[model samples]
Target chain A: MLKVAQPDRPDALTWVFLGLGLLLLPVGLYLALSAPPDVNQGYLARIMYLHVPGAWLGYLAFFVTFLYSLLYLFRQDPRHDRVALASAEIGLVFMGLALVTGMLWARPTWGVYWTWEPRLTTTAILFAVYVGYFLLRGAIEDPELRRKAAAAVGILGFINVPISYMSVKWWRSLHQTQSIDLTTGKIHMDPAMLQALLFNLFVFTLLYLGFVRFRSLLAALEARKEEA
Target chain B: MKLPVEGWPEAAGQGRVGVVRRVVLLALRDLRLEVRDRAGLLSILAFFAVMLFIMALALGPEEEPLRRAAPGVLWVALAFGSTLLSTRAFALEVEEGTLDDLLLAPGGKEWIYFGKLLFQMLLLLPLAALALLMAAGLFYLPLERLFLLFLTLVLGVLGYASVATFYAGLLARLRGREVLLPLLLFSLVVPVVLASVRATTGLAEGLPVAEISDWWQLLLVFDVVYLTASALLFPVVMEG
Candidate 1:
């Protein structure tokens, strides 16, 4: 059952995360701007600072949704469902950011804004899956059924994240391979650029944490109002 | 209406064989009902014919373009047509208020998902074959490799139906499910569609089986993953 007794305001930790992330965002930008130019693409490659973090956080957020969806199914808790919903919503925003930034980067680099390469295609499908998640949530009138259905989508849709991440390796497409390959624990990036990218990733992750918490709190309030 | 599945109550108690029997009974019953109610099946077949004709007309009278387009056109039609049939899988149960009864049956609800999936596969496979033949004729698609093409159909249809049946069951009670099903389905099953289309094209091109096996492997992976995930989730989602 949903606990309508949840606190109405975002917690202190949320404020801290949001503040720290906001404080660091500009610094991250400065670092990204000042970072060494790519040996090939030059300063145009700076988009990776935003694009990589946005995509990574998108994957992370969806993974969180997946975990919470599973928890909701096993535990039958509306709180878990709310978290899943909030995370998915946040994930969509970050993923959209990644896609747009990637396109901007691609036009100057790959000479086309879009290609049907595996990584791009898989990522687009991943985006659509979450979009459908929200659509499903909106169409259902019953809260319980809506939650169950959304959870199922959340779980199933996360399947594409790994596929999207690995599509570069699997298909050897036009999209460049990961600079920081998680599977192989390899780093093929300059230390200064890697540092800036890592910092941006950290800041973006903080913002994501803050946003998800705030959104989930709002969802809790909405759920409480719906019950009232 | 009385539950069409005979001996379902005792069927669960018989262990491994019982689950298999229950699945077959439910599937066969649905198949019989679907066949008896010819309207849905006829419309889907008609949809395939009309769609293939329009596609051929739009892209065609030219052989090379149509041949290249055949696999994509065939799979897209199959994907769309199956959504119509997929909804019908649970629409009858929901209409008659028998879905709850099926859920209330004595054992695990996984079989219900499997049964509905089997029903979709059974219906879609033959229709797919017919659509393939239609494409072959209209689009200059080669079918000298009939057996390989059929293999592609089975793998592809299973991949598509596994997710479709699961989603149909999920959205069964909603008013706007018909519209929503395809939206959700197309996104998740793109890989399956992509692999199937590629495999079909390879077969049509007279590629070696070794070349086409990669696509087959991909389709098999999707089918197995979707089937397992949906089976596990079905009972949880269906429960009140």
Candidate 2:
């Protein structure tokens, strides 16, 4: 008989994860304090700092999901699987906030909240691809196979992320240009706005670490509860 | 690359079968199992019909445009539908623990993979023929491009079955693979789909093969890349 085992709880890493969680609160406040109103877009640009970092982290979180999914395949450990799941969940959170804040910011900036431009289109596809992964997981009954299959989906689906972006660029449509504007000598935002943006970036990264730890702990607890 | 054939216990135990009779006997047993239920033929045919019906409704009397679209439509529909069916070729074994039995038999997992791949390729042929008929009648596309179109479909199916079947092994062990298979497959297949669409559509537009050679070559390249990676990785992905 094949014996499948659960992962034991961590000691030092647990404390480190908790410490990172504690640090996020201060970092988040600094970003908000540092970010001043934009001379160009006014206070509205303040949202960009929160919104943009969230968008960047959204991709970052998903790629983490991909990496851990691969690691789980190699190690066959449930902890990595939980990490992948946690990253995916947090990625979604940030992605959602990014879109909502973008919409809110856009109501004044672009005169429209939703547009089918490449950024939006690619984002929509990313959203769809992940949703499909969840759906695929729901259909499987075996826990082990479920992890393996979902891992493959995580790896394969990354392909569309690029095409989804390229489709916007290739066809030449309504989507906005690249977000990282290096030209014009510098980013066209007020110093106050930059501080706030920077603060939000730090806050969110801390928040992400906190969430990943909490989620990992929950997964571990769930395992213990199941055993009991 | 040859392991010592010294003791059949350890060597044959490693999953290679030298006895022709034993391999043939196993193949016969597999064929019997497949024939007992007709699972492969049934699922592929069922989806093939559904795709044709939907395509007809979607096109709706636009025969000229339909003719050009037929190749792409057929290939995409076929690629997806075949994935649905071809995956199950080894599914029953996986589910019932027969897979372990086979793995412990004469040849190991690689032999099992080849057997399943071969079976699926054969099963897809008839469905492809049926789809070709539907494409011709519904879209009113001339069969004059039969050689080129069939060439594309054959290679496309070769690509589809090879990769799809390997992924099936990956999916076969998992629960809810019916949904996961298509998702994983479609992502990996975008490049192949692009090349196939280019080739089929270009030919459908009456462009000579030479004019469309670029797309054809791309499709061939994609097929080779997918096939090599799939064949090499099938063991690791499926077993490891």
Candidate 3:
């Protein structure tokens, strides 16, 4: 009655992705340095230019994934799951970026590369949660059950987003609270810093959209293959 | 094999009460079987007790560190013990083909999910309560925070039960359900795990209520969020 994947629908996506794929590094570099030097931390907090945005966008992708997962749960349409899986994979990728970029930044600023600082620890846990999500999905054989299990994790995993957002306030930790979110930090930023942060936020938001669309397109293609 | 959602429409259109009643009834039946067999409850309790006992030996009678760790140890024990118990719930059902029949009953896939989750909480709460008592008494903590302890256990188990039940349903189609169940369960329960541990540990340490309020709030939020999500996601497992 319903088709899970329809790969033959078109090849337009593949070409568009190829073009975008070539452009990632240059755009990433542009966003990385576009921000001004931090007065407090100097060039180091500049790393926030990348880490914060990656974490922000990862949550955005997963947040969207959470809603569509509900749709899959509510509607029982495999396509919704395909979209969610796509989003989660990208979420996972961006989480990794957040971690890596944060590490590179942390090494120069925080002295030691890591601590169980609430924010960093919570972010790490989120990554583990999603990695475990993909692992559970891969281990299961029944396709429908795989979708269900992943959706369950998708929803559970996102619950961490708010906690991550609030972790600094929730627990005393070494990591400085974000200069932005009202939950943890002093909410004022110099206009230039705020401008750079806002710009990077927009760029990352665009990046997330591109990644999810591409990943979902790939999911649709993968489903089409299974159908074939 | 019949799915639980395909049964008679006797309670049709009765709204929330009817739905809740059906869910409670389903959970009650499972609980009865569990009690009679003593398999689920005994196994879960045995696992929790044995693990706690082992940790006591490992950590020695040193009170300070043990008190610091008491909350986390108890939660970990309960999480793993219930994982073992609830994995068996569906494994036994699938083996007996009862799960298929249950799946065919009246209601949506969510009723089955909610029922199993409720049954899990019922199954684990007492054992968790017992373990918390043993740990508190042995560790020689002031017994004044029993209410707080109770609150922590309720919210923690609620979170764990919801997650474990969802994974059990998901893992029903896979072999080696026991191993896969815990792996899937804890991987997703970190937020709950964090909130619960902090709440319990703070209570054990006799921290002021104002200091630990954040964790309590976090636990409540986690329970609501995960339960709602897993309840909604139940249908996906059913379709598979």
Candidate 4:
């Protein structure tokens, strides 16, 4: 009979993460909502408070996925694979939120829900690649094979992310003359708005740190079940 | 007349010449197998033809629109066709259990990877020609940019094939990879697809060489990066 390995008990750091996330998120939300709106975009600009932070967290999550994947390949540790899997899952959720929020913001501003804007297009591709990563994980049964394959995808996908972004940028700029695209160049904001955005970014980073701890513990328990 | 083979260190002659020989042998074996079983090649060709016909119909009978859309249509078809080609390359090995045997071979797994990559490139050449012919016939494309178009296709397909072959091998052991391969593969190869379409479009429209150079450079950079990365990573993936 197969035996699952029991996950270790959660320690003080996990509790600390939970406490920080719980305390910071609501305060961050209060600041973001209370901050003055953008002069250019008005009240609608508040979406950026959520959108930008989510997007940053999404990128950060995938970066962690890439790091853990590389470590897994080098060290052949199941723990690294578990950490990679957890971060990728979180990254996908954040990216999906970012995409949706972006679309919502674009609707009133750009006059369309979707545009072939380089950033948007590149993010969509990045999101799809990770979705496929999860699908690949589901398709393989053997633990070692699955981990190796997922790590390969994770690493390659990370490399391709930048290449696709550059290609999209080149493709767009070459085809269309740079007429001051909405997302490019400089953005101006009131100092209060900047502070609010920074606070949210901090909160979201904490949320991600907390979420990954819980998720990895869940993964460890799952691995234990399989082992059992 | 041969000297005692044991006296010669195994590492002496088995350096570059040996790796090259192994790579060539593996590539030829795949190509030979493909030749013997023509179903895979024929199906892909058939798929290419049908895809072109569908594109033709979808764009209607207008020559001007068809001609303008020709570059995009050609590359899109090739991208899908190459997906099928690469997936089949590994799927056959997986089904036949030859993958394990190949992995068991001592050293030179990179040779096996290049072998598959070479096999994919070979199959792509004729398929691309056929697709080009279809585009020319259906879209009424002028042959003025044929040279540039050919170069774009070669580079674009090389980049696309290298990456696709890498993933195909990676996913070959999994169930339901048929669906997952293209999903993951297309996302990663978006750059290759975009560059190819743009470069081909520029050539077809007689854009200045200076303007087209950007696309050419992107394609070249992508091919170099992906090809080298795939070569280095293939051994690790196969070892799994």
Best of the candidates, TM-score: 4
lDDT of 2 by residue, B23-132 (tens): 45555566677778786657667777888878878876777778767877777778877877766677778867887776655433455666676667666776787788
For each candidate, the alpha-carbon lDDT, in order, equals 0.84, 0.67, 0.71, 0.83
Can you list the residue pairs that collide in candidate 1? none
Model 4 lDDT at residue A166? 89
Kindly list the per-residue Cα lDDT of model 3 for residues A49-148, writing each as its tens digit.
Answer: 6778889877777787787876776787888887788778888888899989877866655555675566676677778777877888778776777777
* Candidate 1 local lDDT, B68-126, one digit each (tens): 89999999889888888899999899988999889878767889999999888888888
lDDT per residue as tens, model 1, A66-113: 999988988888989988898899999999999999899778776678
Off by over 4 Å in 3: A1-21, A27-46, A74-77, A163-168, A173-210, B1-9, B13-25, B35-43, B205-214
The numbered model that scores best in DockQ is 4
Model 2: lDDT of residue A84: 80
Least accurate 10 contiguous residues by lDDT in model 1 chain A: A178-187
- Per-residue alpha-carbon lDDT of model 2 for A1-228, expressed as tens digits? 011123465445544645764676566656665566555666676677678888988888888888887778678887787788777878888888888887897777766776655576566566666776778767766666667766766765564466435434433321135332112113486666666666667667766766776677677687577669
In candidate 4, which residue pairs get closer than 3 Å at backbone N, Cα or C atoms, i.e. clash?
Answer: A2-A228, A3-A227, A3-A228, A4-A224, A4-A227, A4-A228, A5-A224
Interface RMSD of 3: 4.4
Q: After superposition, how far is residue B46 of candidate 1 from its true place, in Å?
A: 1.1
Model 2, docking class:
incorrect
Candidate ranking under lDDT, highest first, comes to: 1, 4, 3, 2
Candidates, DockQ: 0.40, 0.17, 0.32, 0.49
Give the distance in Å from residue A145's predicted Cα in candidate 4 to where it truly belongs: 0.9
How many residue-pair clashes does candidate 3 contain? 16
